[model samples]
Target: MVLLIGSSMFAQSVSAADPSLAELKKVLQSQIELMKPELKGKVKDLSMDTKMSLMAILAMHSRYSERATLRQVMTEVLSDYQSVLAGIMTDNPEHTADSARRLANHRIPVGGLLPYLGMENISDERLAVLDSFNSSVEGNALKLADAAEAGDMVKAASLIGDISSGCVGCHGVFRSQPGVSDLLSLK
Candidate 1:
């Protein structure tokens, strides 16, 4: 795969160039910018070496910024979300309510989500965006719990869809990792 080859090349370059983490990150950002047009379906004759270098840089950069605790919390939330879905499908109100409540009240990591997300300079606008996403998710989650408690599976199903949308929308905005569609030819 191109990504694998790119990462291998990047690892080699990191050792060869001996650049600081900051320098590598700078290169990675620029490379991603360069690839944007190509990624968006424009035919750019960017060199394979340059493309591979970008991949390698991204691979190396991600190693330095891995968020273990945040990942763990997200894993827990995902599990709870699945449990809620399971409960709803099986018509178990207690199970659905409990999982929905846990999802709504999932613990925020120390220093909060934004810091863990590596937003160095927090602006009110960014904070507002995050708040908007969080509010939608939490509000819908609570409504899900209420609906489950009241044995209204129809309402609970709709709330779950809303919660899924909120999570995906927030991740699209804040997550640094490139998705499959972002990296590979999609035709």
Candidate 2:
């Protein structure tokens, strides 16, 4: 198939470029699938050379083991968020706020292929829009903790909503399964 030919050809060049072609493929495929949505059909648009270039960038940027760790980190973070949400519902604002502060204090490893890249694209342009979302999540967590400590239920509830907006923004793109963005293109 065309994919095999492309991959095979790239493999030779990549192998010559470096002896880690197999590892490169593994890392590239996993990461690309992870960010397939954000890439926005960029793969299909790329020349073999460009795709190879992207693959090289990916291979050099983050290791496969590192990605696994990143995934685990996200899993833990989301689990923590669930605990925080539950605490809020049960009138346990102090606990919820404490949980929220965990996220606020953390740098929040991003999801998808660009986990280590920190919201960068192939062009290496910082996705500036995501910065605001990050700030919102961090900022609201602090405010939520403050509101909860003050026993201001109304303000705490409002801050939770604000925090959720940030989560929604990130999860919509990053948490979805591979091929989701190109579902219509799949036969």
Candidate 3:
């Protein structure tokens, strides 16, 4: 597959350098940018695990800053979400549907999202809540795609709000840490 080959080539090219975290992040970002067009073209066909596996390869070979890698993945997801919103605003059903599919299939973080949010202790009850949050977002994203494909713009628009709520609820639960508020306020 192209993804594997790209990662392999990238690994070979960088292996001798012993790149710093910043350099590694930079290379990964560039690689991601290079792949974006190809990704957009085949988002619907891409399995949910594709991006994750690619990132895993990079992480495995590099210093592997989990937060930075997770942030990069989230950045890609944000772009897809923006495209979906733009499509809705412009009444472009095809774009909306495609972007929604991308959103639904965005990669899981290296060890999953909860640990990144500092929810490392993940009891069964916590996991159930996490699963609920994930289902809400993924399910709504799929429904959004269906609505857009069916030309039901109104329903698609409503699903966007539901998806946002799901994301916000999950963040509120996991990311509302003590330093987060201070960090957000910029001291």
**How far off is residue 172 in model 2, in Å?**
3.4
Looking at candidate 1, the ten consecutive residues that score lowest on lDDT are: 1-10
Angstrom error of the Cα, residue 34, model 2: value is 19
Which should have the higher TM-score, number 2 or number 3?
3
lDDT of 1 by residue, 82-110 (tens): 99999999989889999988887775332
- Our tally of clashes for model 2 stands at 0
Give lDDT for model 3. 0.56
Rate residue 177 of model 3 by lDDT: 41
**Model 1 Cα RMSD, Å?**
14.3
- Ranking under TM-score, best-scoring first? 1, 3, 2
**Candidate achieving higher lDDT, 2 or 3:** 3
lDDT of 2 by residue, 1-187 (tens): 0011124456456554555776655554444444435453544444565454445434433323322334455565577677667767887878878877765654222223343332233332333334456667767877877887788766777877788888787666445342222311222
Cα lDDT, all candidates: 0.55, 0.51, 0.56
Q: What TM-score fits each model?
A: 0.56, 0.49, 0.55
